[model samples]
Target: MSEPREITYAQAVREALRQAMQRDPQVFLLGEDIGVYGGAFGVTDGLLDEFGSERVRDTPLSEAVIAGTAIGAAVTGMRPVAEIQFMDFITLAMEQLVLQAAKMRYMFGGKARVPMVLRTPAGSGTGAAAQHSESLEAWFVHVPGLKVVMPSTPYDAKGLLLAAIADDNPVIFIEHKLLYKTKGFVPEEYYTLPLATSEIKRKGKDLTLIATSVLVARALEAATQLAQEGIEIEIIDPRTLKPLDTAAMIQSVCKTGKALVVHEAPMTGGFGGEIVAQLCASEAFDFLDAPIRRLAGLDVPIPYNRELEKRAVPQVADIVREARALVRGEY
Candidate 1:
């Protein structure tokens, strides 16, 4: 096994972007404040110095224009990685992504491709309020021609990002704001994790926890506490949501016989519902277990108050509470 070094999630993402641009001259980055200001979260810090202004260009505060321009550049033989300051602001760019970049290949009879990666910071905890802190991955996941990726660990963030940049299709890469400064072991060199794949973070037999983005960390912390009560919870991170690793999920659910889908998104129409439906449609449905549960954000806008904001999303205590209920047949 290769030795790993500790680094923050933001650093891992910056490293991946740096390495991708270095290896491929066609790859460039453009977004508001990404060049001189180092991005909204400093993920692009120092890139302007290393890659220069031409490749690390900055644009006006227009999400629609940024998306449109990147899509144009992508189809014209340039690999462009655009940032949307915040995932919530991506609403302004939905037209270009849904109509243009997503359908370019099919619309052109396979002669064209939009090799672009859209990176954005998502989730709450910084009290950024409603507009700045919404988990909207489900929106892009519903789009056909786009790939959605959310990495919980620093390692997966770097590896999956590299893969997304290299993919020929449009990829939506989501980073949790709370995860930015969190540290984990990551390789100094470049690596890529296959898209549409899921990884088992922890192994257990009592139940299977399928979480996304920031909730993955919460699930792991809950798993540790649940273990003391003789309840072993197997945690799975479906890093890529669109081409979800169904086989891995089915296999885990079959073994555990109980499943819990966790995410920071709201419970109503959240991505967790999709996962539960997928499991029910698959052969894993015959596992003969307790009903699958989804512990997600309350069906309300994120509040500016720190206490209310924390209550809006799933926390370690919430996971432990929900998992205990599911295992005890209390749900």
Candidate 2:
């Protein structure tokens, strides 16, 4: 075997899209400014030249139309991958996604298949402000038929995205803007990661740090800092949010006897709450040496100010502080 090649997260995603399209003629892309303009973040650059306008289409600035059209295509035996310029704009297409695409299969008694992938950039980095920057994965997780996936690294991003495109259901694939430039070793060949599976990024015995999206990178940094003081923290990334990998999280907490949940979303109704609830209800509750803690973004909308935005979400320091307190039984 050879060493894996390193590539930016955005490039990995593009590679996955190109491979999937080449593998299946049914695969196509639809989004705003995704054609000649590449994309809002250049993720789809050069795709138009390769796949041409028919497949790599540029749609109007209407998220609802993009989503509704994708749903229509999916139901008609076409695998369409639609891109919402920003995850926040997904609010404009909630009806098409939540009600129609999500319920079509069940309502029709399994006769319909909505094999569509809705890719959007999420999180508060890059100073996109409140409206353009929001971690809204939790909202989709509440819906039954949608599969939510947030890949933290380039490797997972490519593999999981390929899997999302092939899945016979609506998949809300969220890519954090901050992770786009981050590079990781990814295989050049085609591969797929199973949805709803949790990955243990690092193994430790002191505490379990379950993080999602961009926070996964922060948690890993915090782990390295904590290790200098002899504190080992296991880090788990629940890549697929909707069908959460609760078993992996529970087992980690059971071993370490301490757990800390972290995310970039506002703490109010963030997915972290769901993870804490699962831990409390599971058998791991008995193994807890201290209260499970959650460190998340402020409840207010994401601030546009650089300093304020940095303060709004959890950083490496926040994770370190919370992990220290949890391991020390400070509650």
Off by over 4 Å in 1: none
Q: In candidate 1, what are the lDDT values of residues 1-331, reduced to their tens digit? A: 5688999999999999999999999999999999878999999999999999999989998999999998999999999999999999999999999998889899889999899999999999998899999899998889899999999999999999999999999999999999999999999888999998999999999899999999999999999999999999999999999778888888999998899999999999899999999999988899938999999999999999999999999999999999999988889
What's the CA RMSD for each of the models? Answer: 1.0, 0.8
* TM-score (all chains, Cα) for each model: 0.98, 0.99
Score each candidate by Cα lDDT. Answer: 0.94, 0.95
Which residue pairs show collisions in model 1? none
Give the clashing residue pairs of candidate 2, or none. Answer: none
Per-residue lDDT over 1-331 for candidate 2, one digit per residue giving the tens place of the 0 to 100 score? 3678999999999999999999999999999999999999999999999999999999998999999999999999999999999999999999999999999999999999999999999998788899999899999999999999999999999999999999999999999999999999999998999997999999999999999999999999999999999999999999999788899999999999999999999999999999999999999999998988999999989988999999999999989999998998886
RMSD of 2: 0.8
What is the Cα-based TM-score of model 1? 0.98
Q: Compared to the true structure, candidate 2 yields what TM-score?
A: 0.99
